[model samples]
Target: MALRFAILGAARIAKPALIDPLSENPDASLVAIGASTRERALEYAMTHAIPNAGTYEEVIARDDVDVVYIALPPAGHCEWSLKALEAGKHVFLEKPATVNEAEARVLVDAAKKAGKRLIEAFHYRWHPLFRRAVEIVQSGQLGELVSAEAEFSVPIVRNAREFRWQASQGGGALADLGCYPVSWLRQLTGAEPEVTSAHQDLEPDGIDRRTTAHFSFPNGLQADVICDMDPEGGRKPPRLELVGTKGRLDIDNPLAPQYGAELKLTLDGQETRETFPRRPTFAYQFDGIVDAIQSGQPVWTEGADLIANAAAMAAIRRVAATG
Candidate 1:
C-alpha cells in the first residue's frame, strides 16, 4: 500500500519541498491538498494532478489519508500537526516547527499521546553530503572539535505581500533560513547551545531581515550562524566551516548538494576535497519518510531533537530580543 499524504495549506514551498520528490518515490502518493478556500484547494490539486482537494479539516478527516503534511507557515505548524496526529494520522511538519519551543512541546506531546509518527521536514539532513559531513565530525578526523560557523544568505524578497515580511506570521531570516545551520550545528555536536549573543536587522513591522548569533556548547565547542535576507544582503551560498585541534573542514553548499556541494578537509599539513552524488535531497527525504513509516525505523529529525532545536532557536530569539 502506498503511503498517502494530505497537505494543509496551498503553500508554494510544498511544490519543490515534496511534490517533486514525491514524483520519484513510488511508495508514496500525494492524495489530497487543502487550502484556505475550497476553490483554491481545487485549483492547486488540479494543477498538481492530486486527486482530492478541500478545506484543511476536511482533508485531515479523510480515512484514506495516512499522513498530514503541514505545509502552512511556521505559525500554523504546531496547531495543524497536533490536529492531524489527534486524528490518528502521522505528521510531516515544515521547519521552524512552531513559533517557539513551548508550542513545539505541545505538538510533540500530542503526537506521543496519539501514538502517531511525526517528523520535521529538514529535507537536507537525509542527503549523503550532509551525512558524510556528520560522519567526519564524529570520526575524529577534525580532532577535538574547536569552533564552527554556518551562513545562509539570499536576496530579500521585496514583494509587499510576501508572508515572510510579517512578524505575526513567523516570517524572518532566522526562522526561514537560519534554522538549517542551527539544526546542523546541534545535530553535529549532539549538544544544546547557550546563546551568548544575538543581533538582528528588522523590517518596518519588526520582522527580522538579517540575524547573526553566537553559541557555545557544553563540550566547549563554539559556533556562530548568520542568516541574511535583507535588501543589503546579496545571494550567499550555504557554507559551513569547522576547526579542531588537528584539522579543519569546510563545506560549500551543504544546504542542497544536488545544486553542487564541495567538501574540503585539511589535516596535519595535507588537504583533501570530496563530493557526493547529485541526487535531489528531497528524493532521499521523501523516500526516507516512506521507509520510516513502513519499517518503523527512527528518522534523524524526530523526537526530542525537534524540541531541542526549537529551544535553541527560541534561546537565540530571547537574546536577540535584547538588541
Candidate 2:
C-alpha cells in the first residue's frame, strides 16, 4: 500500500523539485493539496489531477490521507506539523523545522506522545552526492581533515512582499541558506562542533542579509560557511570544498534539486582528480521516513542536531543584534 500524502500548501517551491519527486515515488501518492484560497486550491488540484483540494484543516482531517507535507513559511512549521500529527498523520516539514529550539522540542514531544513520525525536509541530505562526500571524508583519504570552506550566495529577492525579507516570518540567510552548510558540516564529520563564531548583516526589518559562520570541531577540523541573500553572483558561488591533510574535495551545486553531480577528490597534494557521480539516492531518505513510521526506527537529523542548529543561529542573531 502506498503512503497517501496531502500537501498543506500550494507553495511554488513545491512544484518542480519536491512535488514532482513525491509524485514519481511509487510508494507515495499525492492525494490532495490545500491552499489558502479554495478557488486557487481547486484550480491547482484540477491542473495537477490531485484527488482533493481544500483548506489545511480539511485535508489533514481526511482519513485516507496518511501523511501531510507542510511546506509553508518557516514561521508556520510548528503549528501545522503539530496539527497534522495530532490528526494522526505523519508529517514531513520543510527545513528549519521550527523557528527555534523550544519549538522543535515541542514538536518532538508531540510526535512522541502520538507515536507519529516527524521529519525535517533537508532534501540535500537525501542526495547521493553528499553521501559520497561524507564517505570520502570519513574514509581517511582526506588524511585527518583540517579546514574547509563553503558558500551559498544568490541574488537577494528584496521585494518587500517576499516573506524572506520579513523578520516576523522567520526570514534570514542563516536559517535559509546557512542551514544547509551547517547541516552538511555536522553530517559529514559525524560530530558536534565545539566553537562557533559568526558575523551577520541585518536588514532594516531585522532579518539577516548576509552571514559568515566559522565552526571548529574537537578533531582539529575547522569549517567556514558564508550565506548571503544579497550578492552580485560572481563574487560567491554555491559550492562546498573539504580540505584535509591528504587532499581536498570540490562539490559544485551542493544542493541540486536532483541527486546527481560531479565531485572531484584530489589526493597526493598535486590536485590528482577522481570524478564520481551521486545518483539513485533520493529514495534513501523517503524510505527512511516510512521505516521510522512503521517500525519505530530512529531518524537521522533529530532533536540534538536540530537544537544545535537553532543554538548556532541564536548566537548569530545575537551577534547581529549587537552590531
Full-model lDDT, candidate 1 = 0.89
Clashing pairs in 1: none
Clashing pairs in 2: none
Cα lDDT tens digits for candidate 2, 198-257? 788877777888898778888988888888888754445568888888888988777773
Q: What TM-score should be assigned to candidate 1?
A: 0.97
Give the range of the ten consecutive residues with the poorest summed lDDT in model 2: 273-282
Q: Which residue runs does candidate 1 get wrong by more than 4 Å? A: 231-233
RMSD of 2: 2.5
The TM-scores of all predictions, comma-separated, are 0.97, 0.90
